[model samples]
Target: MPVPTTRDKNPASILIEADKCSGCGLCVNVCKDFGLEIVNNKVHQSDKALFGCIACGHCMMVCPTDVIAIEGRTLSPVLMFELPEKSQAADYESLLAMFKRRRSIREFKNKAVEKEKIEKILEAAQTAPMGIPPSDVHVLVLENKKQVRLFAEDFSNYLKGLRWMSSRWFLALIRPFLKKENNEMMHDFVKPLFDVYVDDMDKGNNWINYDAPLAMYFYGSPYADPADPIIAATYAMLAGESLGLGTCMLGAVHPFIQNGKKASAFRERWGIKYPSREGLVVIFGYPAVHYQKGVKRTFAHIHRVS
Candidate 1:
């Protein structure tokens, strides 16, 4: 279903042949502004938001089998955005308005998101594309904060004591002039969730992951290459954004889990097999804040040698 803008008017009467409809209700689900609804396993014209339909045609794209007809027939037809016969300043102005509207949100309202909504976001994540063809990747969705905390704590313990190598051995063997890295690394040593984003993680005050509501972990298989898990995790994050959810990538924990003695323990607790070193973790939550405006960015220079 395409959203009909001012330049593109909605056909007087668009018809959907119920007989061809699979009752998937993708049109209703995808077009939230249109207020389309699924009733009795069929799509019912929603009187609530019919006027707001932008006719973006997303509904037509999501339909699995041919079912919806825009104008009068059941066959998929070519829908085009009508351009003015003559150029006008208003057209470009409107286009810029739409382009400037999207912004990445960091803050979120205190309102708790429903579990069903979170599940929907996960469903979208599952649909994300993979880098390799049918590669081995495991996606773990941390639905609860406690689970995420446990994973973080377990990872933190794994990281403990390992810093002695970089702090003591490397410094002693290599150039003595190099600044003491152990102290800095230990200071930076975060107890997984406790240290990823939060500034304070002491017993009394804890702000790890900035009190995020959920986390998602991506684990690669032993048989797959190291980059496989990372690519999958990246896909999941993009999918999260499409669902209007906030995400943050947590990288430190994965390294600790792979090289430390606690690695086996963490793997057993999560019931996940230790893959290659490429395991990745990411946090997802309803943002505690929002950004109404986009920050300015520096332009990058590119050259094509060929």
Candidate 2:
């Protein structure tokens, strides 16, 4: 039977093989949407579904007998993979060590990132969890240093065109609407960032993307969750680190290129899909320098209810 969702016009098809059904009830227990139930001691679609099936695949994934299959809305049973052995997984200490080794590397070597490494990074990023089952994230890959530099130059010029936004009069006009903290941020941080990006670029300095060998901009469609692209970009960064490539996340480019006619034109030229709520740019390259020690970092605070 097919169950429709709010996002998909056509319902997703769920097939249940009666002979292979073990009736363990794991699938029924894991289905958050109440889309599945036991019918005469066998798994079946529940008629009392809240919003029909979202096709999140919990039912299929949890089934011990592989009796259930889902198809539609970019999901397919064919895409299923065998879970890796527990022994193959990384320990907490190893993960923490890798995290400590990762730094925001702005300085890069003259060497270019291998194509295989870039592909592997993208592959790992695709495995990141998304807000929805089928990801709406899009990645724009600038393969080499030349391409990255060209884009940064173009972006700097674009920012220069809108320099009036950083003016004192403009900040004053928007202060009342923006509130105190944001107003101060505009004057203190954002205005200075704009100045440095534009001014430094004029003197052949690239503060935008840092002239890395490779850069990836991850963005989302109108239907995508704001965090989807960011999570994917983070995954890409971690993958780059694992591959021995230096990486840095550039957040300044996204918000600046999200509005106005000129921004739209720039997006069109670059094949960027939508003016996403959130996006991220990560640059990767061989390291030009190495650090002997890592600094410890802490959160602002951690609250415990208990």
Candidate 3:
């Protein structure tokens, strides 16, 4: 009787061609799960793997002879492609210039963003790295100003029900239970933010989404790493910048819509899959104003162990 491989039990599959394998040990060395080993002077799947094949494609991507192939679990060997020439890529100076050019644009022209540009931004963001093999990031796209305003209105109404969360009595009651930093943040930043959003909305001003022509909300599932959606949103922002679009990341919406029955219903209405640990809303449109200069930015502290 033959032993059942990981693929036999799961959807992930791997293929290795003995003739093409150079046995250079690159695949074996890079297989962190110990799924590959040298057997009979050739690279072969090892039975003593830690957790079986994860379909991460490390072996297939590293193999110079193209002897390995991985498929299933939303991945395939056909997805592999040759990287661009190194000389065509951006150098440090050019990359830094692009980074410095990015600004959080709030004032937008009264115009619509073309659907093709939005699609291109999404295409570029799709290349962002994920914490796992299959990405769990979800995006809610409000393609027009009306849709964005409608969402903002719905969110504002939802916030009314949870107003007590920011009340002084509520803060006093929860301060003892919360961590020191959390309690301080609740009193100092979160409470004021809630007030500003709700109050501004009541006065007929849409402070939530800023009436941008295109708004994208990136979120993650319960099992996802918190940084996954954030990184994806950042990528989308940069892609939008490259296409001559103004972009601003809205960080306030995610936390307010994360808990309670009302929040759940709001998420269901928008088709958000999970209460993500971290999320971001990026708004895109043509710029209405331009700045002549940008200020330098730096971290508050940096330390080197050496």
Candidate 4:
């Protein structure tokens, strides 16, 4: 059986150069799917594979000899590159410092983000794990403040039609079905958000995306794990910070741009491919405001259970 993903339905084809095989069993040992084995002093495809070759390419990546190659399912030898030296990677302390320095910046300078920075942000985001091979995450890049504002305005207009969802009667109707926290969130948070995002936009204030210089919408297909786009968005946000660009994740857009014919039409206008269960939009630019101090944050709970 092959692992199903949005990109491909079939398992990757493994090509073994039996004549070049050293019978070292290196590929066999590393094949977590049990897709390879050595028999009669030659490496061969195994019959007892757990899920055939899902094409993680671990066997090819670890092989000392270039005897195994994976083809199809978005796997290619050309995609391989030399790993960066461990010493060149960010240390824990430096990474922690970067994390601490980052603040959710909404107000931004009018200057545009450089194209090179945008490209590098995408490059780093591509390295994020997607819970599956050949990540299904797709990104829509709005490269300038004008484009971002346009999208924000369009989204605000869209939200105008959805205002009824935040009405008192609607909240009262749904309160009994939702958890206490969700009910409170819908009432105290989301309702006011609806007012500000739409009404402010009507008054020529772009509260939706804050008119940032750059924006990226990371989303996934139906077959994608819901966390895929969220993880990619986080990576992009961190990449923006590393590139000296302020960043903020806009949560209101994705949920609204899903379901119903109107939402589908809006997505089509913006070139979005599919309705993802989870998605995020991150706006980037030079920050208008700077913080002198870092805020300490903690998780609600941390547990270690035996």
Candidate 4 similarity to native, TM-score: 0.95
lDDT of 2 by residue, 12-97 (tens): 67888967887789988988777788877888888877655666888888888899999886778988899999899889998988
Candidates ranked, most accurate by lDDT first: 4, 2, 3, 1
Question: lDDT per model, in order?
Answer: 0.57, 0.89, 0.87, 0.92
What does the lDDT come to for candidate 3?
Answer: 0.87
- CA RMSD (A), model 2: 2.1
Clashing pairs in 4: none
In candidate 1, which residue ranges exceed 4 Å CA deviation?
Answer: 1-113, 163-170, 173-200, 204-208, 296-303
- Model 3: per-residue Cα lDDT over 141-184, one tens digit each: 99999999999999998888888989999999998899999999
List runs of model 4 lying over 4 Å from the truth.
none
| Cα-based RMSD of candidate 4 | 1.5
lDDT of 2: 0.89
For candidate 3, the TM-score is: 0.93
The root-mean-square deviation over C-alpha atoms between each candidate and the true structure, in angstroms, is: 15.5, 2.1, 3.5, 1.5
Model 1 / residue 5 / CA error / Å: 48
Which is the better candidate, 1 or 2, if ranked by TM-score? 2
lDDT (Cα, 0-100) at 217 in candidate 1 = 74
Q: Show where candidate 3 strays beyond 4 Å.
A: 1-11
